[model samples]
Target: MPAYEIDGYDNLIAGMVQPIVTQSIIINQATDAKFERGTVLARTGFTEEGMWVCTIVNSEATPAEEKVPVGVLADEEVDATTAQQRATAYVSGEFNRDALIFGGTDTIATHEAALNAAKIYTKRVVK
Candidate 1:
């Protein structure tokens, strides 16, 4: 008998996202090696030249800016272990509440208002 490998897909988006607005951002390598889809992101407030670098939203982050939820990562997986990787993020969209990823002790309630301010809405999906 041969061993088999199985992979499952996780649907992150739950509602319509007309226009499909997206933003190209750099995922800071220091933040985390890999991030799954629907991972909440926050701008580190640092820009090299012009490209913006972002990290997972952390409630305990200092300076306040980094604590703000900016958007949700749109990539299935982004590996930035070696160096910062450029990835697409949904700046405005409706996402599945249960599918979102957060850093530290943060939860959906911790970022609901911030996300809404950024035009990112979250809703529960029964499936």
Candidate 2:
């Protein structure tokens, strides 16, 4: 007889507002590197082939836009190490703060205002 195995999934979103808003964005291979579910994103304010490009939001970045949190990555782990890839992002929604990934000296306190401004709310999930 052969042995079998099973896998489990993790949910990053804690809650959502009515009519969830999402956008198809291009992950910048040179900047983003890799993407995991619930990774915060920011617009690079540039596009390639007519699609908007984005990368992980960095609080220490010099660019104003790069320091702003615009969306949350709503996909499974994406390997953008080799080439740019298209993925979906939650433009506006409620998410679990514990599950979110930050970059470059960013913390929930640092980007709280920016996240609120963008209509992306995060909740403290007790678990």
Candidate 3:
């Protein structure tokens, strides 16, 4: 996995000190691996932001038994031209969108890098 570094900022009012801290780790993916509702996807080096917005995209048919309790999934099966296409899609459910934030002090370049990393780290489906 490819890795990168990001500089995070924190401010101290008492000391009047603004410190830039570096966070190093492997890239994060925008797309997540396909899993059933009950599946427990491991949370590894994902940062607080990552964990906040982290979601599993279902790329396959959901079993009736695996349905989420919150009435998220509308259908058991998603339509795809081929199995390959289907595997790239996310599951039908109410994903956690609370992770999104607006108007932060972070630089636009920094945010762009993070977004790009997500694309690179996306999970792949096997035929």
TM-score of each: 0.84, 0.83, 0.17
Count residue pairs with overlapping backbones in model 1.
Answer: 0
- How far is 34's C-alpha from truth in model 2 (Å)? 0.8
Worst 10 residues of 1 by lDDT: 1-10
Candidate lDDT (C-alpha), each: 0.80, 0.77, 0.23
- On lDDT, the candidate that comes out on top is 1
Order of all candidates by lDDT, from best down to worst? 1, 2, 3
60-104 in candidate 2: lDDT tens per residue? 888777888888887776668888888888888787777888888
Poorest lDDT segment (10 consecutive residues) of candidate 3:
66-75
Q: Candidate 3, after superposition: displacement of residue 38 in Å?
A: 0.4
| Candidate 2 to truth, TM | 0.83
Ranking by TM-score: 1, 2, 3
Query: Model 1, residue 117: what's the lDDT?
Result: 84
Pick the winner on TM-score between candidates 1 and 3: 1
